[model samples]
Target chain A: MKTVQNNTIRNGIKVALWEIRKLVWNKAFIISLLLTPVIWGLFMGLPRLFEKIGEPAAAPTTYIYIVDEIGIYESLSQKVSDIDNLFLRKHSGPIDDLRNRIEGDENAGYVHITEEIFETRLISVMTGTGDTHIPLAFNTRLKETLTRYELAMHNVEAGDIEKIVAGYFVSVSPVIEESVDPMDRVRKWVPPIFAMIIFFMVFMSGMTTMQSAISDKRDKMIEILLSSVSASSLMYGKIIGNFFAGLIQLAVYLIYALMFIHFLGIPGLGHIPVHQLLSYIISPELPLLLFFALAGYLLFSSIYAGLGATMEDVMNAGNFQGIIMLLPALSALFISPVIGNPEGIIAQIGSYIPFTASIVMILRITLIDLALIEIVIPVVILLASTMFMAKLAGKIFRTGMLMYGKEADPKEMWKWLRQ
Target chain B: METLLNIRNISKQFGKNTVVDQVSFDVHKGEILGVLGPNGAGKTTVIRSIMDIIRPDSGEIRFNFQDNNNFLSQIGYLPEERGLYRDSRVTDILLYLAQLKEYPRDRARKRVLEYLAKFDLENAGKMKIKELSRGMAQKVQFIGAILHEPAILILDEPFSGLDPVSQDVFSEEIRNLARNGVAVLFSSHQMNLVENLCDRIFMIHKGKKVLYDTLLRIKQDFGSFKCEIMSEENIRDKFINFKETEKIEQEGLRTTIYLKKGVEPGQFIQKLPDNISIEEVTIKRDSLHDIFVRTVTEN
Candidate 1:
C-alpha cells in the first residue's frame, strides 16, 4: 500500500468538514433553522394583528343617561350636542334601574352626578361593557361643565367662571435646526445590536461545538479519528465548522427579519435608506467589530470544546465543566449595564476582561464615539487572551478525549493542562 | 521477518499507578502477535500507545517506515471501547473514517461496498448504526478499521460481541490480511481463538510481561500434561505425595493431576497406587486456555 500522509491543516479542514456535514445535513437542524424566524415573526406581528382585529367597525352613537342631582342636565345636554356620536339624555328614574337598562349594551352608558362628586372629585361613568373606555374628549367636557356650575354656585360671575376652570396647558414641539436623515437612527444602534448578534451567534455556535466534542468522546470515535489526525486538528475543525454554521443560521434569520419588515410594512423600518445602512455596515469599524466578535468566539469555544471532553455525558457534566459551557453567556449578562452606561466603570472594566470584552467593546463603540486607543487596547487584550485560551484548550483536549467511563475532575484536568 | 512496528521499553502511568511497565514487543510483517492478559492487564494501554492515541511515559514507540509524520494513517486501530456515530449512516461514517487516513473517496466507496458484502451487510450501507444489531455493528467497525488497507492493524479484543460463526469469519479475514503481509496486533480474552490464529503470544499480568515466545515454545515451556482419574471415592490425598504432580484438583469422584513440566503421562501413571478404584483414566496435554489460566494464577 502506498503511504498517504495528510498535513495538519488539511486534516483539520477534513475534521471541520465532517462537523459541518453532521450539523448542516441533519433534518432537525434544518427544521429549527427555518422555524426560528417564523416563530420570531409571529411574536412580533401578533400584537399588531390583535389591534386590527379589535378596532370598532364604525362609530355608534352612545346614549349617556345622566342622573343629575345637581340639576344641570339641560345645559349639559346642550354642551354635548356638537359631539357627533355622543348624546346626553335626562333620567328621572332610580340609578339602579338605569344601570340595569344599559348593562349589556356597549353603546349605552350612565353618568351618576351626585352632589358628593364636588367633595370627592370622583366621577363614575358606568358603561354596558365593563371594558368600554370613556372617550377623553367626553370626560374633559363633563369636567368643564361641572367646574363651571360649581364655580357659579360659589357666586362667581359666568365670564369669570370660564377663566377659573380654564387651567394652563403645555405643548412639546421639537425645533429642527437642520434636516435629519431617517437612517441616522439605524446607524447609531446597529453596531451595538450587531455586537449582540455576534454574541448570540457565538452562544449558539459554541454550544454545538461543545456538543460535538462530547459526542466524539461518547461515541468512542475520538481515538479512531485521532489516530489519523492530531487532537488540535479536531478541535480547530469543530470551532471552524460551527463558526460557519452559526453564520449561516444568522444569515437566514436576518433574511427573514428583513422580509417581514418589508412585506408587513412595519412602520419605522420602512423608510430607512437601505443603501445608507449598507454603507454604514461596510465602514472601517466593521472590521474592528468583527475582529472582536471572532476573537470572542474563539476564546469561549475553545474552553467549551476542552471542557466537553472532560464530560462523559452532557447530563452528567461536572459543575466546573457546566460553568465553562456558560462562559459565553457571561457577555449577555453585561448587555443591560453596559448599554445603560457606555462610558461608565462597568463598561470600561468589561471591555478589558477577555470574556466580556467583545460584547462590551461593541456596546461602547456603538453607544458612544470612542477614542482610537479605547478600541486598540481592548482588541490587543482580547487577541492575547484568545490565543492563550486556544493553547490551554488544546492541552486539555488531547488528554481528556482519551478518558472514558467517568468525568475528569478539575485536578486531573489541571494535571493534563500542566502537561 | 521484517518488523513493521517496534516498541522499546515503553512504560505508562496513570496518577501513581503504573498501567504499563517497561513493555517491549515487535510486530513483524506477515505475523499475528496475540496480546494475552486478564482484565486491567495493560494490553489496551500498550495498543493505544502504539497507535499514538496515548503516549508512553518513559519509552519509545517507533514505526519502522519511511514516513514518520503520516505513519498513523498506515496503522488501523479498533479500540476495545468501540462504537460509531449512532445517528449517521454506515457508509458515511466509514467514508469519513477512511478519508481521515487520506484514502481516496472513490476507492473508499468501492471498498466499503466490498466489505459490506463480505460481512453479509449488503443492504445496511444506507442504514444508521443504531438500526444494526450488535454483531452487524461489530462487522461494520471491523470494515472501517481495515478499509484503508493499513500496513499495521491493532485490534483490541476484536472478537468480542460476536457469535461463533461471525467469529470464524473475522478469524479467516484476519488470517488473510496477515498472509498478505499485514502486521496484526490481536488482543483478546478468547485464548482458544488466539492459540489457533496467532503465530506468537505475548502474555502479561498486572502490567508486566509474563510470557513472550512463539506458540510452540510457549506450549513446550508451560503446557504440561494433565491426568484425569475417575473413581468411586475421593482420591484427593492419593496424589499429594507424588513428586511428578505439580498441582492437584479433586472434585468428588474425579481427580485431575497436573504433572511437572516435561514429565510424560505414562511415566507418572506407573507410580499410581494400586487398589485405587480407578473407573476411568485419561491423559491430555494442557490447552492454551489452561496454560493462560495457570500462568495468570501462578503470578
Candidate 2:
C-alpha cells in the first residue's frame, strides 16, 4: 500500500475543514443562523411597523347620564367624542333612570351634577370596578375632558400649555459633545454596539476553538491525529476553521442589521449612513482592526485550548473555560469606564492590554478620535501577544493532549509548558 | 524478518512519576508483537510514544523506512481511550479520520464503504455512533484504524469492550493483516488472546521492561516445573517441608504450585500427604500468561 503525506499547511487546512464541517452540518447552528435575523427583524422592525400603521382604533363607546342641572358638561361631552381613543354618548334622563342604566349593561358609567343651595357643588362618576384596564382608559379621558372644561372656565388656553411643554418657552438646551461634527450623534451611539459585537465575536469563536481542542482530546482523536501531523498543525487547523466560522456569523448578523436599518428604518439605525459605515469598515484602519480582532481571538482561544486539552470532560473544561471567559467579561467591564473617559488614563492603559485591547481600543477609537500612534500601540501589542500565545499553546497543549488517565494537575502542566 | 519499527531506550515522565522507563523493543515486518502488562504498567504510554503522540524524554524511535515523515501515514493507531463522535454518521467520521491521515478524499470515501461491507456494517454508514451496539462500535473503530491500509498497526487494549464474537473477528482480521505483511503491535491485559494471536511478547511492570522475547523463548526462559493439585484440604501446610516450592497460590480446592529451578514435577506429587484425598494431579509447561506473572512478580 502506498503512503500519502501532506504538507503542514495543507494538513492544517484539512483539519480546519474538518472542524468547520461539524458546525455547518449541525442542524441547530443552521437553524440559529436563520432564526437570529428573524429575531433581529422583530426586535428592530416592530416599532417602525407600528408607526407606519398610524393611529390605533378608538376605544369602546360609553353612554354617560349627564345630570346637567347646572349645564357644565355640555362642552366636555363634545371634546370627549373628538378624542381619537375614546367615544361618549350623553344621556338626558332622570336620576333614578341614570342609576338603573349604570346598574344595567347599557352604560359603562354615569356623571351626576348638582349645585347646593348655598353655592357649593357636588359631582360623581360611577363605574363598575370589576375591570380596571377599560375603566382606567375611560376614567382618564373623562377626567381630562372635565379638566379642560375647568381650564376653559378659568381662561387657560390648551395651545399655550402644549407650547410650554414642548420646551419652546425654555431658553436653555443641554448639549453633551463640544464639537459640531455632523457624524457626532452617529459616532456616539454606534460604538457601544460595535464594542459589544467585537466582544461577542471573540468570546464565541474562542469557545468554538476551545471546544474543538477538548473534543479531540475527549475522543482520543488527537493521538490518531498526531500520528499524521504535528500537534501545532492540528491546532492551527482548528483555529483557522473557527476563524472562518466566526466570520460567517459576523457577516450574517451584520447583513441582517443593515437590512433592519435599510428596510425597516429602525430609529437609531436609520440615522446611520450605510455608505459611511461601509467606507469606514473597508478603510485602511480596517486591516489593523482585523489584525487586533484575529490576534485577540487567537490569544483567548489558545488559552482555552490549552486548558481544554488538560481537562477530562466538558464539565471540567467549562471550569477552566469560565476563568478564560473573564477576558471578555473584563473587557465588558472595562467598556463602560473606557467609553465614559475615552482619552482618560484608564482607557489608555486598557487599550494596550491584549485581552482588553480588542474591545477597549475599538471603543477608544470610536468614542474619541484617537491619534494614529495610540491606535498602533494596541495593535502591535495584540500582534505580539498573539504570536506568543500561539507558541505557548503549541508548547502546553501538545503534551496536555497526549497525557491521560489522571487529572491534569498544575505541576504537570507547568512541566509540559516548560518542556 | 526485517525490522519494521525500532525503539531505542525510550523514556517518558509525567511530572515526577516516570510512566515509561528506558524501554526498548522491535517490530518486524509481517510479525505480531504483543505488549502485556497489568493495569498502570505503562503499556499505553509505550505505545503512544512509539506512535510519536508524546515525545520521549531521552530516546529516539525510528522506523526502518528512509522517510520517517512518510512512514507516519502508514501507521494505524487505536488508542486505549477510544471514542467517535456520538452524533455523527459513521461514514462521515471514518472519512474525516482517513482524510486527516492524508488519504485522498474520494479514495478514502470509497474504501470506507468497502471496509464497512467487509465488516457487515454497510447499513451502519448512515447511522450515528450512538445508535450502534457496543460490539458494533468496536468493529467500526477497528475499521477506522485499518481503513487507510496502514503498514504498521499499534492497537492499545483493542479487545476491550468487545463481545466474544467481535473479539474472535478482531483476532482473525489481525492475523490476516499480519499475513498480508502489516506489522502489528497490540497491548492487552487479556493474556489468552495475546498468547493465541502474537508471535512475540513484550512485558513490562511499573514502567520497567521485565521481559521481551519470542513466545517460545519466554516460555522456555520461565519453565513450569509446576503441578496443579485439587484437594478438599489446604495444601500450604503440606508444602512447608518441600524446599523446592517456589510459590504457592491456594484458593478453595485448587492449589497451583510453582517449583524453584531444578525441581521436578513428579517430585511435587511425592511430597503430598498420603492420608489426604486428592482429586486430580496435572503437570504442565509454563504458559505465556504464567511467564508474564512470574516476570512481573519476580522483578
Find the candidate with the highest lDDT and give its number. 1
Best by DockQ: 1
CAPRI accuracy category, model 1 = acceptable
lDDT of 2: 0.76
Off by over 4 Å in 1: A1-6, A50-59, A63-134, A138-179, A271-277, B228-242, B251-255, B265-284
Q: What does each candidate score in C-alpha RMSD?
A: 6.1, 7.0
Q: Cα deviation of B267 in candidate 1 (Å)? A: 3.8
- Please report, in order, the local distance difference test score of every candidate based on alpha carbons: 0.87, 0.76
Question: Estimated TM-score per prediction?
Answer: 0.84, 0.77
Q: In model 1 chain A, which range of ten residues has the least summed lDDT?
A: A1-10
Q: Which ranges in model 2 have alpha carbons more than 4 Å from their true place?
A: A1-7, A43-199, A268-280, A313-321, A403-412, B225-283
For chain B alone, what TM-score does every candidate structure achieve against the true structure? Answer: 0.90, 0.87
lDDT of 1 at A321: 78
lDDT of 1: 0.87
> For residues A1-419, what per-residue lDDT tens digits would candidate 2 score against the true structure?
22222466777898888777887788888889889889876877698798878865555555555666556566666645654444455667677776665674533666665544114433456663433123454455555555555556567788864453345454554576367564656545554455457557766887888788777776666777787777877888888888788778888888877765666554544555567666545644445555555677788887777767777676654444457556666777787898789988989889888888887876676666788899778878888988898888788788778776545767676777787
